[model samples]
Target chain A: MAARILIAEDEPYIVESLRFLLGREGHSVESVNDGAAVQARLETYKPDLLILDIMLPEMTGFEVLRRVRESEITKALPVLVLSAKGQESDQQRMADLAANDFVMKPFSNRDLINRVTALLPAKTLAGSGQAPAAVEAPMSSDRE
Target chain B: MAEISTGQRIRELRQHRGIAQSLLAEQVDISPSYLNLIEKDKRKIGGALLHRLAQRLEVSPAQLSGVEDASLVRDLVDIARVLSFDGLDEAIAGRLVAQAPDWGQAMVTLFQRYKDASETATALSDRLSQDPQLRELSHAVLTQISSIRSFAEILKDVPDLPQDERAHFSGIIASQADRLGLSAREMIALLEGNPGDEIERSQAASAVHEVEDLVNAQRNHLPHFETAADDLRRRILAAHGEGSITAAMLAHLETKHDVEVRQVEGDAFEGLVEEGVHLVDLAAPRTATRFDIARRLMAMELREEIEELARNDRLSGEDARQVARRAFANYAAGALLFPYVPFLEAAEHYRYDMDRLAQRFDGSFEQIAHRLTTLRRPGAEGIPFAYLRSDPAGNISKPYSLPGLRMPRLGGACPLWAVYAAFAEPHKTVAQFAAMPTGERFLFVARRVAKGAQAAGAAPAAYSIMLACEASYANRLVYGDPFTGGREATVTPVGFTCRTCSRQNCGQRAQAGILQRA
Candidate 1:
């Protein structure tokens, strides 16, 4: 499956990693640095999955998510809250704001890809996973 | 944090694992030249190629990208802020992060202990230097000892040592010993650091925190004070006040409330005392006199309510209670001078032009700026602003702030903040769009408020006041009118303070962030 993803983050280095990982995974990706810009572009990009960081300029990721949940169009948009603030309270706030997933900072690339892959709709999976999926599918069936 | 070159990281990882370059390169399916290029930072590697190398090297991609060991950089930054590392500057710290991360962590740990020890010593010394007469007595004893030494030298040089002269010298030596031993009992008590200023500093710090909590809990508004100020204004207007606050309002207080306002210089009398009212330096410029008058009025008229608020708030210490009382009086003064509802309306209408608003209200720029922070009235709310005041000497006087915004607590704020710069241009305001280290942008503005008049003998007290809000709120502010929505062009970067701020590129940073270690 292939999906258009938008990463709302400020750190250039982290942005590069996400871009490379998602691009290699065959997902179309775009990014915005500031919090307000995230909301502005969410509708315009209409990304299937939104990866957002909490600490952003102009506004915060929480503020962006609040707007996303309130808007008619972006209400059901699959949003993942990424933050350096990894406390339970922070996660709860993100969950309360209706984020689909939460990713902690200094995240493992493998863990991040897996989470992103899981969050996106199955129909959006890239063709590269098809052969592996087919093999795994038969194996699971045989076990059953 | 400065990034460690990919080559250096690879080399460190390889050496640590005892793997040869050619063996590693062949295993990763890269030419030895390519490996060398990556090692020397002559080649940029990312995505597939970087991951391929990471797999063969048995390291995470984050290790290659300077992400996994980023905390080491942060630790180095922190250590640098606290203590000096002559051989380990930022670049060297980055190298250490890539090559020897455990060493960096050790440095951070050691520095933390060292800093704690230093602060304890400072506090001890501060507490010991308290007694006055002890210093005078110590100096007298030292002088007496020096005189005795001189007399002994003269007696040694004299060829005809007379018996009477020897007796005289002996008598002087005896007196010297007597003087030295006389203050010996008193000197024992002066053997420790002075805690006087330390206690006062702690009290001031705690008091500010207490008030901040109170302000934050109330959503930055005081409705009762607002209502009371409004009532006072209506009463004054009903009385047909005709002049500045000192003339009309003071007269009204004197005639109606039987409260006389008197100016007394060289005295600590502020707010109100038993003799009706006694204010120190009543003729100061801008709104100091007006504020003094307003504070006195609030102290007299609303003493019961202020006391009740303080009592109910449950502040334990006398210092905190005194600070809270003064805070309430000042709040009432600001509210009385600039009534909330109209001020908010004017703020909105003028886009929060502090000077214009100050002129309109007959107050100082600092007054209007401070008053702006208090407009948290629920239905008629003003812009959420973080206000701060720092004197020319870099001492922060007012540090009222919200959650995202923190006023610098240790080693002063970043020198880059407009508030510090305002001292260079007295009575002038500087407007800017600043970004915090966290990438949160602010509509920052600062102005130097010169108190007192231009008299030959009077040296006016001068300090700078600064106010800021989130950049998105800039459209609602005239200060940010020029920059508008985009802040890229005029973004002056700053951080909270040296020890804690994580900004890597800030030139004014005295110390590194906690994560940036040696």
Candidate 2:
């Protein structure tokens, strides 16, 4: 069974890449650019898993998680948080909010796919054995 | 249910391992009574004793600390599962633990308890549907139980737990539960009922097991998750459209990388400006920022070195002042090559490796730190990288950047910054965490390399240079291996801020300055 995945990230490139990756893995993917749209999207789209980023425009990813956990309708929905802020405190806070999983930024496409596959409903994760995911070369940038 | 104290755990572990108290004491080289006191929770275990206990128990010192337990293990697994995308390894985790043990343990415990409680609550809620109040009470009780356990462990050293303190702890726990919408009375009642509730108990057991799985996943996954996240953030920033990255963006990246950047501003030079040599006055017109003037002045000093090399004669007093002016011009040129803002961005992007930054801008290491300081261009300034140069005997020769640090007006340098240690290490990089007398801690990396030397028989025969910046800014420099342990050994206590420093024992006091400086 294909898992319905929702991506809440402000970065277009990241969202696009993640969409392409999960789509290839045969999971249904929906995305929003900010935290404000999460509840509305959940109301209609009903994603089985959510991939969220910390630094969003209006409500933060943390705030979104709080609201999701608070509402009876979406309280049990599995959430996977994504963040550029990788402090120990940040990871702990995400866990405190009951996020199903977390992945840091600058992720490998294969690993991202693997983590998503593993965290999805067990029926969706069935075929993926615990073998090492394939590595992808990082894109070059002039900033560094 | 009764909870085991640290003392009880120690006694149990000792008994289970079949080791007698006296023998264990001998292994740790401590008196048996001292070991007894620790096991009884009569005394707190210090770092050395904790290390010995870990060695004996075949566990990490963190495990011996009694702050975290089985639930902590589960949280670690959960975090690792989320972070597995980054390709982080055990080595990185080891380094993180070594650098900050207490924080690591706290995180592990908090995550584990959260997962366990949530799962237990869910199952109990389903089982006690006929008794909503009991269901709510059960959840609250479990939450409070975990909170009280953790709090007791943290405050075990407080000997006597007063009623008010216990109430305060319970209040905090209740508030947290209320915020989470969990009810206490309901949870306790669910636990109080008949033996048939065992089915629900099994469900709760499964929740605990699931939490353990999550913890294991986190322990294995977090490093990779963090690394991947960092890589993604960098990619996002690199492809950032329209505008240059802002300070907030940089701060975001810094937080992601778990590194800090320290910025140092140039100090006020009292006598030099008034001496009528007019170096400050001449440079003021050409420069817009204080850092620009400071760099120009430093460059002028270097130019005098070049002139003395060419002239092959000692500069007369008037001629030396003239050389200072020329050195200022050299500084202006260096500043032009590596302007503050863009350079700092580049520095962060490259992890502050000097050679890499030098190649990027075609500038030198000294020039990079020097230009980095000048990044104090009002609104768009960079991190303050205080620049200091000292001779073999620890005499302060140049205090170009972070004048507020008050780098000795004459002879005030701390031995702990690795600035002096650089002499022994030569080209090798030495990094240290230094605490000033006033308890302001700074990370510093330093090296010893000579600038243009005086001729064979000048008034100053040998001049070696020592370069250092605050450790916070060292992420941009390539000199030291920062990830290694022994941070405690490397921490040297120092004080140079005249107004703020409180080294009452020092004989080289020019004047006492401010409190809480740095």
Candidate 3:
């Protein structure tokens, strides 16, 4: 039930960190570096939730959101906007576009996990529950 | 709710102290009519009057104003109720009372009312009376209402005319009132007159229309450049995320571009150039002055703070000022490096190719991008542009624009802008069609770039920068071609007027301005 999540981010460090954390949470993750590939990848992979960075190459997150909202096929898909642009107007704009949620970059790992976890379907949660349990058990064992 | 007004309190206090009205007026140094109005709640007591009243009344100003007393109103209410039962009202009719408590007859009526209401009523009354927080809240609410009423009264002085004309006048007043959160009825009440004749109505309508039109024009006159500048900014920021603008980067940009940048010092003013100056030339004089003032001010403000730090033996005053001067010099250097005129012409000539422009100016991609916005010289102007530079983490380092543009006061730039996208692609130019909250569209170019750190050995910081122009000028840029996809590229809507941006659909907007609303 773990849903596939796509992360469109330009920063390598951020992408790597997000991949590591989301991977630990047990969702199938596909990461891309720029906005150029977003539409094509969405058509093929059809990610259940798109984690999009506001600043992207070739296209901006806004343009991507606009296109996503415009397209009949993926118009209903939930998108969680991730951005380094931490402005009230920016957040307000994202909210107006019907984005499921937004998280600023340089974000807390826990916050990211909470947001990603909240967006996944119940089935996906159920599927990923076992993986996180396994992962937590190892860390707890190490403490012991 | 019917507690004594500040003026009444002053009067009451004066009488209690056995002071004459004229003497109190003298002490307060205000006209008797003004004092009378204050007591009747027709006017508010100014701070100066309050201070003098306190001095004359032998009480703290806060106590006289009832700002410090919670039970003063309840005490008056109780006194009034007791005095009512004792026929104290008749006593007042019979003799002019000249002191507090000497009017014990009035207190009798107040006390009787309190007794008749019973203990439960008394407890409720006590709760309302003794609660300092509630007293403060009530006072604040009353003060705010009084101010609103004052505004209404001021509006009343507007000349009266025909019925239709009055309505037209009312409409304009209503719009202004609406901005101030006042209702149409309230505004009409404030004006206190009706429009009468048809001609007057037409005039009023025209006046309102003119005002609205002026506001609209100002809102719409935001200057914007082509998408190439945005693309250039993105490339620079992507390369140097969240770092200081450095000399090395400036050098690198200069070496790459053929553009000449010369640094000049001093406060001397020279006569204007006889020949018509280019947009860049117009900007140069002011830019120097602005840079000098900013530098001087920053140094003055930081000198003491830096000196204090140095006292802890951390750094010397000289060291601190040196750093400040360096930072200032760097900023000034950036301004000079991107001299507005030549860059604007170059941008126009090259159709805003960032790489080509960079090469032409011998500037780093980011430096050129940042400079694109300073083209706002009034008569001989370049595209009035707003520029923002942010680090990789999205902390805005610099944001500036021409007069009409409204950049966000805090937080970050609009996420809808293409500048953020450029951070992902370091060298490549990114184009975006962005709309402001007001639904105005513009083509933007953004890119990522790097700048060297302070010391020679330190690693350079990577940041993202964005140069944006209005969509009206997009036809002059080559960057729009990609978005066109063989067809003419649809002009992307954007705006610099934060208050009126109508792009309600934007997720990056923190607050939709007045015009952005449906």
Model 3 CAPRI rating: incorrect
Candidate 1 C-alpha lDDT tens digits along A47-133: 878898766778977789889878877777788777532134556677778777767643545567788887776656744332111
Candidate 1 chain B: minimum summed lDDT over ten consecutive residues — where? Answer: B113-122
Q: How high is the lDDT of residue B76 in model 2? A: 44
Candidate 1 per-residue lDDT, tens place, B1-518, comes to 44666788789888998999999889888898988988999998876677777777776565576654554565565455443323345666677666667656544433333333234323443333354444333333333433343343333334375889666765664565455444432443455456465446534554564554444444456678889888987787667654454565687678767877666553345434686555546455647778888887877778987887677443545766778788888999898888887888888888888888988888888788989999876456788888888888887766766546756433478788899888888757888888877788887899887766555677878888999888889888878877875747777877767665676776787766664653
TM-score rank order: 1, 3, 2
Instruction: State in Å the error of residue B183, model 2.
Output: 88
* Candidate 3, B284-395: lDDT as tens digits: 3333333433333223334454343234321223433344344433333444345455677888888878789877766767666655654543344556566667787766
The TM-scores, one per candidate, come to 0.49, 0.27, 0.29
Instruction: Order candidates by lDDT, high to low.
Output: 1, 2, 3
Q: Candidate 3 chain A: worst 10 consecutive residues by lDDT?
A: A132-141
DockQ of candidate 2, scored on C-alphas against the true complex (2 decimals) = 0.01
Candidate RMSDs in Å, in order, are 34.4, 29.3, 30.3
- What TM-score does the first chain of candidate 1 have? 0.83
Model 1 lDDT at residue B397:
66
Candidate 3 local lDDT, A10-60, one digit each (tens): 755456556655775677889888998898898888777788876677997
